[model samples]
Target chain A: MEAYNYTDIQCPPPESSEIELCRILYSEDYLTNMGYMRGIMSKNEYSERALALTEKIINVCAAHYTVWEYRYNIIKDGSNHNKIIKDELIWSENIILENPKNYQVWHYRQLLIIELVSKSSDDYNVEKEFELIDKSLIEDSKNYHSWTYRTWLTKHFKLYNDKNLSFINSLLKSDIRNNSAWNFRFFLLVNNPENYIEQDRKSIINGLVLQKELKFTENAIELAPQNQSSWNYLIGIYEKFNLDINNLKGLSLKYSNFEDDKISELEMQPIISSVHALELLARIYSSSKTTVDKAIRAYDLLATKYDPIRVNYWKYLSSSLNTT
Target chain B: MVSLPCSLKVAKDNTAKIYDRNGKYHGKKQYNEGTIDDGELKFHLKKHLNYFRMLLNFLPNAFQSNDPIKMSVIYFNLIGLDLCKGVEEYNNKLFKTKKERSIIIDFIYKHLVESGEGFRGSVNLKLPLVDRSNEMNESLKIVGNYDPANLSQTYFALCILLTLRDESMSQRIDRFQILSYLKRCQLPNGSFKPLLDIYGKPFGENDLRYCLIACSIRKILQIDKIYEIEELKKVDINIENLYEYVLSCTNYEGGFGGEPFDEPQAGLTFCGIAILKLINKLDSKETNSRINYHKLVKWLCQRQIWYNKYNKQELDEGDNGIYDNGGFNGRTNKASDTCYAFWCSASLKLLKLEKLINVKGVELYLLNETQDEILGGFMKNRKSDYCDPLHSCLAVAALKLLDSEYVRELKDIDESLVISKDALNFMEQLKW
Candidate 1:
């Protein structure tokens, strides 16, 4: 389907000067294959070469629609080389207003922000990044990348600091099975430093439990027993609740070897493979911080039964033995 | 439906019947050395060679022609050629054919709209260089100007440009200019307008499918950086919603509809499946593991009901798999056609489950029902001989994907060109 051409309505005859300009500039595509070469070069080396070409590319396409794009790339590529990241972004912002639909411009802007966060000598302003993410969301409310960037802000800037429960709730309400949102929520739940604190343990676990069904998180282990992430989360929940040791061991074995006759089935299997779950379970059980000997004994039995390739089980055994 | 018991004996018997007359034991068939008549194995071998031959000969004149029709023909033709090999890699012959190949490459560059940022199908004959020049910029603004029928044109164009080792064209691309065109076409609901700046405001049924194509193209081109990753991240193409929308498109008997929340049609099924594959690539993670890719595979397998003898007449009537009409829900829905088989089957391959299909049956259907032995093209299905370039190319691609040996010869894309699924996983693991 050709775009509905309203050019008939708005396009006036090109002035002779305009036509001449088009002729002079039209065939003059930038000869720089620098981007591809830069793709092959080391970062430090490319930065110097990229700066030189950026000037040429910008000069050639400055008034052309694609110049803003080339210029943006030079800035982004050189972002770490200098402190002028904001200046490059402002140039991009001016161009994006003309082409809001330009995914390249939007992508460049995203890279700039991420660069800013990582390159900041002082801790980056998480709040400002969050605002940008929110603004991106308003542009296209369902963008997974924006949600992903937001998740970055929450982790690094401490923007979602201590409000992990509220954050999880908001994500769940938006789209229950947003896989990225679900994964992000899980990260917050398990890594909540407050979860390790004496007072916040029970509350954090409860918060994690509430968000479980949002992404069908509880069912993931049943559906794909090999999914490491799901198993990891489930084990987190088990340790959080101080579930019975023998029962948990039996549960782990039951879900270990998922059916994998087909490719899709095999792809699904990785979701439940008990690697992360086992490690978390062992850490919870061996530590005097969370539970008693029951959890440790459970880990010991599991290690013995699964015969995993990892040392988490042996470490747990020693820790439990010493504690007892 | 006749129960043709699927056994190796029957296969042997069928192969013998095909080669009974050429009975020179241990003697080679004079046509192509070492292609002897040993019965079943020899016949299958020759059949594959013929398939390859047909595909190679069917190469559209467009690659070498300056004519628009010829150029458009090559647009679909290269896909047919690649489909013959069953993988993404080029053979030594592609590199060896210097002069003719360079002509095609030159044609692409020469016709590229200088004022506009994209390539058009061909050079106009009647129009002067001046008028052609006048129209180039206007034409370029609507990069999505190509139809959903020609969705694969851009794919082929990118492939051709990439194969030519022309980094300058890609580098010269105002990635934003074309992307801007792509963005306005996207509906607020995350679907894409089939055409740029069309419908005033109404969303087309194929918008999501187009969006998927656009994103996949960006991925293939190795310019994901050009897209606003954060912008896309914030958009909520949640798997469940997409899955539900796909389900809603299903008809009572289980065909995919052309658009979201419509009756299931075969072409739309391809579109739906493609969208799902795209979504899976973009957003798969722990919490939404319930989407169940296995069930989708099962559903696709069940959709091949027409292979039954009872539906043989429908095949004869040219109702292959893709349907355009809305039938069961008090409306006539389109049936699955040749091109859709490619789309649907390719979607399955992306999920790595193409083996579940009955390769022989589909091959036979495509050969007997759709292949235009007279013209170097295929119809939508059997009984109809009118060829659409898009469907013709896709049928070849679908058939090639089913041939395991041929697929083995095809190359996987360069790692640098594609983001690893593991990297996607690592990114997903992060808090933001």
Candidate 2:
């Protein structure tokens, strides 16, 4: 009954792992994954074998979080660097830190941060890294690595301030509807209640409302239809501006009913992106009827386009087309 | 008015009739009353089979240089023959071309080994197997060591065995081993992954084309034991996800996209309907087993804009190959392709609604483009002057299925294999 049995399966662990990795690398036949990595080193013409070794380690260590942090260090320490490179390094660190059980690695990371802060002085943005680590800890409070890293970084880097605000702003900017980002913002704002006058909080909150990513508030609603935060934010903003809020409340009520219906059906659908949420909004906007034309236009804008015939978009369009 | 030596004369006439007698397409467009129109349809029909014949006739000569294009055509032609006529036709042909057949068989044998990891099709490409490694070259055309059409190509490779009537070859394929690879590619919801992911995890539901390709493989190979039908029942009614996926590819107009709902493509429409039909069968209700034939008929009809009483093309703008209308997605008002006419025509016929479609108009459209004035095999688009095996065979299948009288003229030849009787039965079994 088991799908996997040792004798029946020919997929050798390393061979399979390398084959998988090679598929992600350069897809060539002669390049047995180990040989492929060797080829990558030679092809890229790295000055040293250690640099090549670092790349190999990163490629093979896809499943290991600790190795991701180690790989980040190697890339950051190397001379050739850019914004994307720095971003990727931070992403690699975040991925490793996603699993908070690796306390020893987190502890090691803290020691490295202190050494780097003392060595680089003003150059390193140590405070931002601490904030990211703290955010990860908040997501999973039980994660000992996150808590330990947070305490260590806070002591070494001092309180989060304007120096780290840009990083915080970018996360929300990239994905405004992200609950994690919103949660982190609340913590940072409330953590230092005396940072400014009442006017500062209003301005920061207003800036967030006007931010381009506000359009994705619908996306947040789509992900967690029960999430009152986005609705509250919109209502809060509307009330402050003296705009009508009744329609928004009605939409929220409708979504709650829809969520109940979805749960009753017991379909476990994952929420992938903000645009996916917009799909549901397009539905609500259409009053439970098909939004054929608008749906088509929306999908046209999506990079990974949807299928017209399979979706009810075209069925409705066809009906409308027939009537026309 | 009947021609002499029907089979020989018909074959020759079929090839000749496909070309423009007055050569209007070749700048000699003056032919008076009662004459057929001159166009690329003739040339394309002839070219399709001719290109195929070139590989089969000179297969050894072509294989010595190991030309990928020639080999590709050869492989496709063989697979087309099997699909249209089944393994029986292939086995009969194999006996006549035994010596040359051995060479082709040997080439296939080399790749069908466990060591080769389930028959990687065509080793002559320069690209890698996965996509991410070439991230830096995102703008450049993605290349793979294996053809992107590997699943179809492998199915064709398996068809080669069935054609050879090699019972032993089927056993040697380690069907379960290959099925395991194919199963690994399936998504949790019963759709198939297009290929292995960058990290080697199989990514399912790549496209509608691949979906049909995977299904066709299962049908031809009879790979039922690999998956439990009960497990698939969980997703039997879960049409929304697949529908939504395909819907994502639709444009302003009602035309379907390439795969899982790609852009409005005639071939993909056929693919979409076929996949839906397959999914519908799994529901196990006689009433619900039938697909959304009415909607499909509407979609198929939407793509048809008649150019003349005797000619019809797809709704696409220009030549995007078989799915082309006038130019590649240029304007919907342009002429549709003969292939689309056949595909939509056949689809309507399968749904038992051929009467609802413009059968005579399509028949004339295909008839005017047939190889011999009397035999049928239409070109893809009006611009294509030659007919290849794939289109020719599909046109033949479409025509024979639509016109039973034409099929009966073959005298003792069974064309049941042409339209996939087994697939039809599979469809019927799922009828609600």
Candidate 3:
């Protein structure tokens, strides 16, 4: 399906080649674009004339942020709630589908969402936001725009629960290294989750929430032993609280695959950055240098053998061990 | 796969070969077998000089795909030339006489909106929306209406002018106007937006990128160094809030992202550290007290991805890639690209940890692997044949970080502006 149908809005051919040359030299589209630019530049009153101009221009060019900013001022100042804002939401969806990476399109849509919610949040239709994000994220799983907007929707409209966690869980199952989903899971489980900040600080990450997150991440790590996202989630949980670094030694050792005598896994080497879990385990043994010596050596082996590119980083870590 | 040009052949022998378009025997050419030393490969100065000069031809499609980023393409293309050829030499070649420099400066300055210190992507193209001759009275209507200015473009324009400025170049801008624009664009939270609305509130999103742009502009204009802005305009940087906003963007992973608690990225990490360095907030004592320097340094070093110099056909079985060329990636496990070499390594430089990187490997990657053989511009990656101005510009800058032989001719670049120390000196010499 075509994302945006600008056929009706495209500049029609001039009457003849002479006018077309004139159009090329002094293109009607250029005039339209510059008119909006000049309006925003001069802070001109966004009259009905400016409104018509914006409608025509945004029809063809949604990336012109100056035009969008001008249109925002015009609508907000004049209180033009005459159904244009709703149409703008639909138009923004078309733009988003056409150009998912265009940041300005998402920003414009967000401004429209704010306008609608301020008028009467009950009619905001937040499911549209969810659906729009779903489509965008499906296209690019690492898109922070959709993830950021998802956080806003959850905070403003209470759109998260076990269902959201389950969806993210399915995403992680599909690709165990989807960092965006892992980050979203942290937001839901930990700090400032879904208006949870309004409640007492202690209620933010209560025992149940922490337990569930630990279990979820532990299972994820078990499923994909080499996925850095799983390890990052485990470390993220440890860092979120003022928990002792020593406490994670148990989880680290649990995730460790020292006993898995798999040759195929040995050939397909683990990533260098993924050895943070092993390093954390080494650190846990740091109280006594003699006790930590073996784990530290294991860390070196992982860093050097699996990820030879970052031998310098491994050397740094090993040297710091002696100093500490 | 990108469609190979007709004259090129994807040879079984690894190196791409120049061939006749038709299926015909192409004459044998000797392939350089051994790994070339980084010191041996001279900067392809003439080809790069031609590469950037060709961009100015405006071949009707030179910047067609980059229509939205017109200012950036112009600014970085000029910078790419300046890095390959000396800035003064480039000045002599592009604009010889004083009159010529003035003309080019005015062309850039025309993009500046009168309301603020910002500049738009380009001069707003005038279209014949209304028949000015027939439908309107020439005397009654307004003329010379232009587009609004933005933070990124303003940053590009000011630096471009400063680089192009010499002794005879005049300071045409009112510093107070630009300073006030930057000040007003700051939100209560201290991060900067791209532009401010008519209400003096921010119009767009706030991020580390805008913050860096604002601070870099501050450094170039030397708003603090100049005395006039204190009385003429309110020139306060909500220091408390700004510091808090920047600190908020710092991640537990020892890198920064666009927002607090977001995914850590190399580019945003550069912006954050560069902002701190620019504003004189990068105190090692206070910052290291909180931030894990070991992790941060380790994280930066790990951004060096495995970049094998040899193609598949050239690689022997069981080769461990010990002597492969190295390049920086933006994220933890992403493919290496040209721009992040500057972003990641420059941040490491600011952190006093540049020594940890494999300098020789990176220099060779920038000079040999990523550089296009035919056009002399850097591509997004080793595999890409297309030339991107921003990538080419940053690769040259990253090459400077490696202390390449070109350093003697090129200007010394500080971490913040990515400009020649000489050009920055020239910027400092400008009087309001």
Number of the predicted model whose lDDT against the real structure is largest: 3
Q: What TM-score does the predicted chain A of each candidate obtain versus native chain A?
A: 0.37, 0.31, 0.75
Query: What tens-digit string does per-residue lDDT give for candidate 2 at B1-432?
Result: 112110111111222222333533422332222233344332233343344344344433213222222233444455444334433443455345665555556666544533333554433221222325645534534222222224545565655555445445554665555555565565654445544432334432255666665655555555443246776434222344554444443322233444321124556656655555544442335424333333345456544333211111110111122212111111132344555655665555545554444343344445443343323344565556555555665555555555534443321211212234533343234311
Off by over 4 Å in 3: A1-63, A73-82, A156-160, A193-206, A250-274, A292-303, B1-43, B57-69, B125-146, B166-170, B226-234, B307-325, B360-369, B382-385, B404-409
Candidate 1 is graded, for docking, as incorrect
Candidate 2 regions with alpha-carbon error over 4 angstroms: A1-324, B1-51, B59-72, B79-103, B113-117, B123-149, B188-191, B203-205, B225-255, B259-262, B280-292, B308-334, B355-360, B367-379, B385-387, B404-432
Ranking by DockQ: 3, 2, 1
Error of 2 at B225 (Å): 6.2
Arranged by TM-score, best first: 3, 2, 1
Leading candidate by DockQ = 3
How do the residues A252-310 of candidate 3 rate in per-residue lDDT, one tens digit apiece? Answer: 76644433425453232322223455666666765666766865675575454544455
Error of 3 at B78 (Å): 1.7
Clashing pairs in 3: A31-B127
DockQ of each: 0.01, 0.02, 0.19
Winner on DockQ between 1 and 3 is 3
- Estimate how well candidate 3 is docked, as a DockQ score: 0.19
Candidate 1 C-alpha error for residue B135, in Å? 17
